[model samples]
Target: MTDDYILVLYYSRHGATAEMARHIARGVEMHGVEARLRTVPAVSADCEALSDSIPAQGAPYASLDDLKNCAGLALGSPTRFGNMAAPLKYFLDGTSNLWLTGSLVGKPAGVFTSTASLHGGQESTLLSMLLPLLHHGMLVAGLPYSESALVETHGGGTPYGASHHAGADGKRALDEHEITLCRALGQRLATIALKLGNDRGPNR
Candidate 1:
C-alpha cells in the first residue's frame, strides 16, 4: 500500500550477509519496485543491555511498519548452527502484532544466508528462516534450476534460496554464482509481489 516496496531485512555479523542484501535490493529495484534495506541489532546476554536506537553504520534498524507495508520481503542472515541469527529471530519474534492482523498474508518472501564453512548448513539456515514467513501466510519464492547459477555455483547458490560460503575466516566474498542467485531470488520475489498486488486491485 505504500507505493509497492520490497523489504530487504537482514542481520550481518561479518558483513557477508549485508553484501548479499545489497545485491538482492538491486534485483528488487530492477522490477521497478522500491527496496527498503533494514537490519536488526545484536542481542546481548546482559539483562540491561541495549543497542543504540540507530546503528553505527549500514542500514537502520527495522520497524514493524516496514514489515506490515512491504509488498514483498527478502530476509538474509549469517548461519548460526543451521539456524538464522538471534538478532533477526528476535526482531521477527516481535512481529506477532502483524501476524495477528494478518498484515503480511499473501505477500511474497524469500530467504538467503551466509555460512563460515562450505558444509555449515546454508540450506538448513535458509529453510529455518522460511518457517516464520510461512506462519505469516507469506507465499515463499525460491530460486529454480532455471537460474543456471544454481547448477554452476561452486561457492554458494541453492534451490532453497541464495547463499554464500564465507570461508573459515569469513573474508570470502560472494562469487559470481552466489551473486547471480541473490539477484534472481530478489527479482522473482519482486515480480511475484507485483502480480499479487495487481490482483488485489486498488479497491481491495
Candidate 2:
C-alpha cells in the first residue's frame, strides 16, 4: 500500500484556485499527513493536441497511480459556466480503471473552487466536482457550520466546500475568511482519512 497522503489536485487559470490548494495542503500537513499536490494539463480543441511529459512549472501532472494510492482527495477548479473545467473533467473521465478496481471507495474527498464573481456559480461548481468522487464511492466531506468562516465570510466561503471570489479581473486575493475555510476543509478531510485509515489497518 502507498503511504498515507491526501491528494490535493487542481487546475488553476488565474492562480486563485492554486493558492487555495496550497492552503489546503498546509492544513492536511498540520493534521500529521502528507499532501501530494498534482495538476492536470489544459485540454485543447485540436483532437491530437498533446502536452509535454512534465509541466513547465507548478505541481507535477497527476497519474492514475497517484489517484489510486491516495488516502483522501481535495479537488479544486476555476468555475467554467457553473461547472468544473474541461481539463479536470477530462482527467476524471479517464479514471475508469481506478473505478473498475474500486480503488477510491471509502476514501474521504472534498472540493474547492474560485470564481470571478460572488454569485458566479461557486456552489454549482463544487457540486459538479463532487459527482465523480461520489461515483467512485468516496466519502464526501464538506465544510461545516462549525467553521465560523462559512457564516462570516463576505468574500467567498461555502458549506459545499471552500471557495474564493477572485474579482472581475481575477486578481482579488483570498480574504481571511476564505483562507480559514479552505484550511478547515483540508483539516477535516485529513482527520477523517486518518481515522478511516486507522480503522482499516495499515495495509489499506
Every candidate's CA RMSD: 1.8, 1.8
lDDT of 2 by residue, 9-46 (tens): 99998789999999999999988899999999888778
Error of 1 at 101 (Å): 0.7
Per-residue lDDT tens digits for candidate 1, residues 1-204, read: 448799999999999999999999999988888999999988876632267889889999999988887888999999999999988988989999988888888888999999999989999999999999999988899999988889988999888899999999999988988888999988998899878876654322
By summed lDDT, the worst window of 10 consecutive residues in model 2 runs over 195-204
The C-alpha local distance difference test score for the whole of candidate 2 amounts to 0.91
